[model samples]
Target: MSYPESLERYAALGVDTEQALQTLAKTPISLHCWQGDDVNGFEGSTGDSGGIAATGNYPGRARTPEELRSDMNKAGSLIPGAKRLNLHAIYADAPEIPDRTELTSEHFRPWIEWAKEQQFGLDFNPTCFGHPMAESGFTLSSADSRIRQYWIDHCIACRKIAADIGEELRNPVVTNIWIPDGYKDVPVDRAAPRQRLEESLDTVLAADVSKEWNIDAVESKLFGIGVESYTVGSHEFYLGYAVKNQICLCLDAGHFHPTESIAEKISSALQFVPSLLTHVSRGVRWDSDHVVLLDDPTKAIFEEIVRCDALDRTHIGLDFFDASINRIAAWVIGTRASQKSLLLALLEPTDELRKLEAEGDYTGRLALLEATKSLPWSEVWNEHCRRSGVPLDTDWMKDVRTYEKEVLSGRV
Candidate 1:
């Protein structure tokens, strides 16, 4: 799984060699089923298949254990040849009545058992009960021992469940922790949250050091909503904090401002974190999570893929949630588009490009774009399909065009 020499040279220039190479060697993209309502038979939000509802209640009820198992089996059957499948949790908050809290283990037990039976890895998020604290902007003020203890207990429970599943299946399982604990009005004592977060992470990490579990601190950026902004600076702050304690970073593409360069941001983040995981989605004025073409002519995503390929960092995760198409289809299309973009980037003539970059030849580098302008995207798609051993169909170009149209219309 060694990278090419060109990438090694790029690494010598202070680009993350190992992280980049590891990313290039693998495309462990996982499909998230967070918006299950987009699929048929499930309830949905009004005006959109899975958008936020006026009432906090999303339009769907939880599927029973038997039904969940059946759905997993069906989803598995639909994509039998997929290289891997990662299951996300069903709820963000403790649902009304909390049906089967003790059976939380039982609910996931079938899916875990099924992945083992079918041989695919599983990734999940730790259950943090106090998500409202981020919006309420009072995490620091509460200082309530009970609230603090609740957070501690939730982390322990999440780790215990992850360990139990990992031990049962003997596979690498990821526990992603996306914090919603920042302030909304004034600058709070950053040290307290950082200390609590690190303490909670240390507690989880210490429980089973031998288990193949990773804790990814997912940094999200929000606009016009909070005093403590969720910007790239915040992400950098956490990565530096995590490095002090040996943790991982999950980079979300949609979490950046529309003006930011995702490639440069990713490159900068990689300088600190050894491994990278990102959510792929488009945004307009801010972080909107719109699903756009990975190779959109805007060139933001294309350039990022090129840098990632040149640096050999390819550990990408597809995070797409749109209400129009089938949720499963959105994931499949997004994954395919991302792979197409990466393969095209790999085909780039790096030696010439690097020379132009050194000489401050922005126009010369831009020529690479014109040269690739006539890149028969169909050929790229076909090549990707062939390399990945996936089936190709005539409808792919149509799908790409439809996706492009959605990007233009800002529906995705």
Candidate 2:
């Protein structure tokens, strides 16, 4: 069907395709930088990935900050709509290397300048893992006071730097904190470590960082590589902490149990927390960060957020890292899939569905829901790509292949 035919169908259901396109175009989806290099940041401290692992070598994986940025630039060109760059503290590029604890905005001036040039917003994360301090699989929640203090200082510095970057860019940055603090085996005393974590978090957030520049968020995980038995920062832990502190709560798509729905969690978290940060990732069985597709889980996340009218308060970011495929293609594919899901949700006839449910017309709601699936949403998607000046279909793959031949193949 043509674009007009698709629009007519949506209009019949009280859906405004034009409005959805406009809203989607304005929404900023932050892309994770670590995907380009399989989470190996510029810190150069290798060995023991702190429970985060990106499988497969696939040649041309970015080995330097410059290469990663160039790859991101290539991926960004094919992805439509507003975009933001998410950075880890380990990606710092300063005159001299500084430990995570001592990182400042000066270490990221080059990144900030590049982001400005690209007209993209910036988000940040404190590198809480992959360093010598996190080799024990515990950092903030460690029983040792010294270990906890180091991570606390690192988080504080990251928050300050994030705020500074946001102030410089005039866009508030979401500084999310995720720690690989957990025990592989069942701990005799879980309460002690949790207590330490609570205390350390209070100290780290004690500084008065302006919200106008920085938005603080805490991410939770069910389990990870070495921390399978017990994850220190579980969902309940972060939920309670976020609510108590009135901070944003991060719900990673791949961090929960297989049957669990991040879509449901959005409604629950937004009830208490001021805002939310969603890390849209695809997890296979475990938290295997695979490239995202326009799958059911991805669609549900965006649908729920739109239904709850929470887009303004929700920050959407991609968090998958698949090394088996082309790194730049991974970015483009995951990001574009996310964008398509959001667009699908935006095009939903939410008011009609709600009205049917409110009137106890479950039959109509069910029928309408199923029937809407058959509509020409693909046509609308094609129009979106065309309007954005990107490839309307799989043609983007040709561009990526050309890049691989001309650039990536040359990389040793």
Candidate 3:
């Protein structure tokens, strides 16, 4: 589908407006703000984190549905144009095996109803069983049947929930599965775990398809388990499995190794699947869900956006966890920056660049960079906010200029 003419008007002002809008349209950005009470010692805590308790026992025991709706509405108002919201929580209290049968449409009905009323979509992620279960390390092929059953049941519940919601709303519910199940140390039978994982996924997808719901398998890099190498096996295994089973790959930008190029990775991943959904975070050492920013050129966040734009992906969810600044401000800034970077990337003539690559010309990339050098960030931001009907914030232009300078200097 072609971009709207309004986007073309922005492109005339020297922004890759058409590409930016297209990239943003493909991915409905959502933030992952699910920290359940254990903030101080949460394993994934980073500079960006925010949440209010969803459950507790005290004088004010339960939060009313109105309270929940208010919180969601507030988040929606903050973003102004966001179309989806992701909720993540760890099922900590259930020590016994999780009962998938207990999970019903009724359980999530209230939240789903609220989301529909508010005109936003819902997605969820359950913490890996290994995070709380393993004292040393947990493998998918672990001898502990309880852990395996826990994960299996969780997936089953998620699929059921997605199917139920889809039936209720008459549209597909996006269910994402990200397992921390990986090898910690060298073991006898690596292939067995891989086989088990494939089988498990196949079963899950089969069950999901039986219910007429869609399932997306998310392959990510692991952290905090003391084992350094967990990348190659998981991705390769999942990609192969997804291809065979017709599953979608959910790509997270922060999960790649430091040495890998984001642009190259996006291009390669898109070859396998037409589009990808990802969580955004900033970290050189660890997977911190920081707001997406071009502060570091080495990360190539901007270039990745450009690559994805050329491919015309389905949706780009701005997955971030924020605790420091006003969450609303963070969302606006992050979304604007992401859109800007994408627009700049689209300005590049891909066909010309391909020809240059075939002839071994580094100058094509440099030429694209130079073309984006004169882009007016302030004007672009102003025009976009006007078009989107969000209040314009001029102060952010300074950082935008700094980002542009860094990009032009090849510092990014």
Candidate 4:
């Protein structure tokens, strides 16, 4: 818990420790459900999805909707503050398997019911990869009219399903569209695929879905496993489309070049796009989707958002899958690290820094920024976890280890 001395130290800087804790408590971080099952959805697929693959063969992977939810419950119990579950289209539950194009809200009725019971918000994504239809390495942007139309219909259905789920939960669900469409080698006509993608997106979003229940976002990638030469949905392509269409632009931390940072794009994108959806992920070497750590890159993301006063317009969601370790612990560690970064960002003396920058006092600005790195924000985080009834520090790991022996071990 936060001591009096720590609280007073932060208070002297014109920052409110109580306000930061409360804001962090209210802020909902969307946890990706696929982590529990290594992105192997319930549609009876045998192989790993396109481009993205979760490495390792760790035991106790969730095998059913119930098991996944149970794992999520255990992870959520260890993480303090509000949370929302991010669902992929393939996780849809139904007695009979339905193709991606034929999916509806009924297929996801079980998930909706579970989320209602848990009292958590929900978000959705159209599974644009892994199906036989997408085996050609292109989906919405495929030159073949038949292949492209099938994906377009699937995306349309996903948006409507997202609306119904959001309406049921009374929270607007962010339905993000990310497709693995590109070429491994240099293509003669890169412009044609991007043009087709734009047209397909226009048709998918043509339906009159209310923003009150659903928000549309387009995600971009620099390259994937096979698409190293050229990616159809490049960052520039989606940024232009999102800005022109007035939809949300999703910036993934792992979707860019190694040296690039999504944190620097926050303020720039918000000036044009209506809102931003940030996928908090760690990219080791390339877009490996490693478990997120509270590293400098992740910290800069929250810092920029809070510094720009764009928390209300930005959506935060986790996007990583690691099958190497305890999945539940992966979720708890990544999510708590994100929440801690947000807390540190909130506790910053932003006004003072901005005042210095505005007055051309660059020396003071740098000095204060460096000094903020050594503040007692960790104490404030402990206080938050204490109030929220979650374990503080590594105490939460003991619960995970016990669960592994009792619950997860029996799965095999």
Estimate the TM-score of every prediction: 0.68, 0.98, 0.71, 0.98
Q: What is candidate 2's lDDT per residue for 93-184, written digit by digit as tens?
A: 86687877888999999899999998899999998888888877889998878888899999999999999999999999999999988888
List the candidate 3 regions with Cα displacement exceeding 4 Å: 1-27, 35-72, 89-101, 130-140, 183-189, 208-213, 226-233, 295-314, 318-332, 346-365, 394-412
Give every collision pair in model 2.
none
Whole-structure CA lDDT of model 4: 0.93
At residue 81, candidate 2 shows an lDDT of 87
Please write out the lDDT profile of model 1 over residues 171-271, one tens digit for every residue: 55556655445554454465666666555556545665434554344444443234334222256556775566555566666666666656666666666
Q: What shift in Å separates residue 253 of candidate 1 from its native position after superposition?
A: 1.1
User: What TM value does model 1 have?
Assistant: 0.68
lDDT winner, 1 or 2: 2
TM-score of candidate 4 on Cα atoms, chains taken together: 0.98
Model 3: per-residue Cα lDDT at residue 69: 42
Better of 1 and 3 by lDDT: 3
Preferred candidate (lDDT higher): 2 or 4? 4
Clashes of 4: 0
Query: Model 4 segments beyond 4 Å from truth?
Result: 46-48
Q: Which stretches of candidate 1 lie over 4 Å from their true place?
A: 1-26, 38-86, 89-107, 117-119, 129-142, 163-170, 187-195, 211-218, 223-233, 295-314, 355-364, 386-412
TM-score order, best first, reads: 2, 4, 3, 1
